[model samples]
Target: MTAQANYNYSYDLNNNIFYSGERQIPAYELEENEIGTCEKCQSTILSLSYHEIDDEFIVTGKCSICGNISANIYGHEWNWISEIFISHFFGQTPAQTTEDSELQIPEARKSLKNEDNGIDDLELLNSIPMNQIETIFSPTEIKAMFARAKGEKCVRQYLYNARKKYKTFEDVFGIKIDI
Candidate 1:
């Protein structure tokens, strides 16, 4: 039997090894050799998951940029849960610099308010880290996402379409998509 198999065979503390205890360890574990990386922000991984199936590890997670599993992380399992939940489920990724979210807009301050002078998307875009940008999308995929953004009729039409590209969304959108 392989070392992995041996580990599963028994929980012999005498051997200085332990079967990730239920409470002490995460409910799930890594199964595959590697998982994809994040679609947004290449800084940190978008998701990392593992599961013990038939006695082995299946792990997956992505970088902030492509949601492509660029790196291989080996260690504790639960450590990544928090990050996955925050980024994959929610759009929030850990900020690089600590900009106060609560900063108040100056009441008297006005930004040369004019129709042509729109808010600087480029400034915001520049401020956005390369890692935060969503990974690229295919023309068909882009069309589907656009449909969803349009309305519920589109959402229903694209719901299954979205699921079909489950892995692709992470690759392009940098977000975990579960239908």
Candidate 2:
């Protein structure tokens, strides 16, 4: 899925937070505020329904007072809070995890090697918002970087070379990326 063109709240990419005017709003609060009132009449009485499309979750609210309907879409990364709000709205308990699992270093290493040999890196890079990518590197620079990284013969070396700029990508995009 592509990044949303218009969002209900403005996002501060540098700070990795959402805000409306001056007040900072968490994901849950932003979602709640979005569906809390009618867009046309500002009425609190709304009948809401949820839908999933690929990696996005959409909440549709119909205002009882003005009969105005609005739909808000959220990305998968915000599911941690959206799931809780969804469950509550539907009168269901949120799923709970038993314990945190330890990371398997060997499996991670193998996965990185596999991705290095395939087009996964390109795909992963494309998954990021184009605006964010352009902020860090131009199209010509990115093409050159990929060509240079692919010249490495060893899988470990290739992986390291390819991911050399990942830290910069993470810092600018405000998302943890493994590719």
**TM-score list, all predictions:** 0.23, 0.29
- Which tens-of-lDDT digit does each residue in 1-179 have in candidate 2? 22332322233322223332344433322223335664335677342445455676555444456433344566876442231111001111122111121111100111122243232333234324445556666565555444443442344554454467667766644433454
Query: Candidate 2 lDDT (Cα, whole model)?
Result: 0.38
Give candidate 2 regions above 4 Å deviation: 1-119, 145-165, 176-179
- TM-score of model 2 vs. true structure: 0.29
Candidate 1 on 33-129: residue-level lDDT in tens?
Answer: 3344344442555334443433433333445453223222243432322221112111212332113322111111212221221322222222223
CA lDDT, candidate 1, residue 166 = 55
Question: Candidate 2, residue 12: CA error in Å?
Answer: 23
For lDDT, the strongest prediction is: 2
TM-score of 1: 0.23
Q: Candidate 1: lDDT over CA atoms?
A: 0.31
**Residue pairs whose backbone atoms clash in candidate 2:** none
